[model samples]
Target: MTKPQIVWLRRDLRIEDQAALRAAAEAGPVIPVFVLDDETPGERRLGSASRWWLHGSLQELGDALNARGSRLILRRGSAAQVVSLLADEVGAGAIHTIRHYEPWWVKAEQDIAKRVDLVLHDGNYLLPPGCVVTGAGTPYRIFTPFYRAAMAHMPPPAPTSAPHFHAPARWPASDRLDDWKLRPTRPDWATGFVEVWTPGEAGATERLKDFLDVAAEYETTRNLPSQEGSSRLSPHLHWGEISPATVWHALDGRQGKGSESFRSELFWRDFAQNVITQFPDYPDRSFRPEFEKFRWRDPAKDENAKADLKAWRQGRTGYPIVDAGMRQLWRTGWMHNRVRMIAASFLIKHLLIDWRSGERWFWDTLVDADYGNNATNWQWVSGSGVDAALFTRIMAPLTQSAKFDAAEYIREWVPELADLTDEDIHDPPNRPRGYPDQLIGHREARERALSGYRAMKAS
Candidate 1:
């Protein structure tokens, strides 16, 4: 007899090219289920933005499944409890899902496996975890070497088509998705965001097509926040509405300067996952131990510093570039990679705040907020991460903005500054009509930042 199988959905939302679902279907009748228990992270439920994206992506996945003569079975509560209950109810002999690397998930999966035959797949990554390791079986410590090694190991996995599936004998009852209340209604600020984002697997493929068709100029235009030079696939990738494998497969014939740059960015994603694999604490704590003693500023006590964070978050910072990035994040729940670096540097260095604080905000707000990327990127900017910039290097927002046409970006987000031409808007004017003065007097803060750096080194 063909034993029943449950293809449990987690981050991997798409039925197309889904290793878990394909594996289950090969066996016999398969049950496609998505459990909305954010407790996979053990008390760390999904972030607001992630939950919002999840609601939309799952709706699309369900619609796709319904078209394929199946429906996404929804469940809530603990992974082990829910999976075991469904397994018994359906007489399912096995459960399968794309493996995840977060510590909380690592633990939960182990517990779930105890009750049911869980078939795990390394489907989310391009080469899977620990595949591209160092000579001694250690993970690559840094990105450049990691990227080189990753490229050498595989060109790109062949993208798979949505598998033909078989339905379960009986459909399981599901919770009304509306009751999930993942979408906000009381304080609806996401309408603009929703209008901008095309969520789900199908949407992800369209985005990939758009990027490849026009990727030749990404090297030059990507930095300009005003131009849509990016793939904007981060949210989709985060939710597993699409996989890195799908992306690599899709880019097989692409050859251009921008293709390499784009691949390099994706390599960073693999690199970050490798970091999380070796060090589960990569999200909360610095990988390097020496800098653990580094003293972070207390925004509550530091009136000037508190003002700086407020300015950055509210898009009111006197620095046009910084304000523009912050405002972009507020309005779109996303920011350009270059602008993200500038804004992150300003918060951690210029403002002398903890990177963790910035990480928390991005976690809550960024629609593409992957735990691995958000933590790694924040650590990278703060120079507290394992493969981060040295603590001595500080980003000059003024020079960076000028270099990247920051004024152009500033005009888009900070409409108040739109009145001032780019040349006049790069720096704060002596007495601008509506704009605030340089929030902390950046020059003074630069010196203070150096002093704090010295203190940290001296400690």
Candidate 2:
């Protein structure tokens, strides 16, 4: 009777550079498992679009495991109970997994550790959260210092290779991917997603290769939504299909501004995790306490507020750039980072809605709707988090669109204005035929936002 070890998979979906999976394989027969435990994350559960991606990603992982003479066990239930029961039933010698930072995941880890030989490894981040800190022994609240401290560490650990062996003489019971109903079928909002993405390890590596080919232009191209300047690796990174270390090692010694810019973007992901690790309640609360006093319109309580939020979500805010960004998110399950900031600013400052409202919407919509990054970025935009942008700094959507040369982006998402010239794309002469009027004039909204900021400061 062989005692098989369990390799529990989470966001770290890929087999390559997988430390825990390899460790489990080295020890004994490995039972690779992915438990969809909705009970664990609770309020921070994966959104609809994310689930859709998960469905395809799991299919790929299963195929990859099969090719390697192993199998990926799929289970749905409370991970603590399900994993523990499986271990006991199989008489497993040990369970290996990567560490995760989500608050609920941390709780599950504690509960599972008490019941099993849970061996934890760190492979989710370029540098595991809290590893880079100030000399005073505290997490760096500012990204620049954190970036400097992290860079001083130089190249990350060499990526571990995927294990080349079979796992378990007989596979355990697994759930069927299709039966889970992870993807929406009735409305099929994700129909566009297939055209834009391939959700697995192979897709991740291919995206990296594409980005590196033009890595030198990344700095300039990343800002222009029209160009394929951005890496578009957020979803893959969020799902752990590709490890940050693998991304880092790929760009190692690559001399170019684009590679350097892209590397900093990766660091920001790690920084968000660091912030969340230091402040567990970060998703719901602000890093700066005074932000609690800041007046935020409750869309749930007021019908008028609700209408504004609906318009923002549907991309009918009369602001061409904001509408374009919102529509892009609905169609593709992703948005350009520059437009994300502009749209976020419009909701927080222009609409006077609470950042949490926008955060929740993004949580439900983005394929890469990460709890840590979403919280950090929303707060950063709203001036509520550590090293946040000033609340007074309201982003003018029209100006942003013009500066980023988003005419092509607007035309792609907002077809109503596709016929307009470059000058008219960001702002039409008198509200184009089919387009809605601006929610509020840009100058008026800016003044209103400043008033709200002043009142918050005065209070």
Best by TM-score: 2
TM-score for model 2? 0.98
Expressed as tens digits, the lDDT of each residue in 87-124 for candidate 2 is 99888899999999988888888999999999999988
Q: List the residue pairs that clash in candidate 1.
A: none
Please write out the lDDT profile of model 1 over residues 1-459, one tens digit for every residue.
676789888889887778898888888888888888866675357877777888889899999999998889888888778988999999997998889887777887898888888889877877786888888878897889888888887776676777777887788899878899998898987776877887888888888888888787877888877678888889888888887877876766778888778778888878888888888878788777755777777777888667767777887768888888887787778888998998898888887888877888888888888878888899988888878987668888888888887776777777777877767778856636777887677788789788888887888
The TM-scores of all predictions, comma-separated, are 0.96, 0.98
lDDT of model 2 at residue 229?
A: 90
Give the Cα error of residue 307 in candidate 1, in Å. Answer: 3.9
lDDT agreement with native, every candidate: 0.82, 0.90
Q: Which segments of candidate 2 are over 4 A away from where they belong?
A: none
Q: Please give the lDDT score at residue 275 for candidate 2.
A: 92
Model 2 alpha-carbon miss at residue 362, Å: 0.6
Q: Give, for candidate 2, the lowest lDDT window spanning 10 residues.
A: 163-172
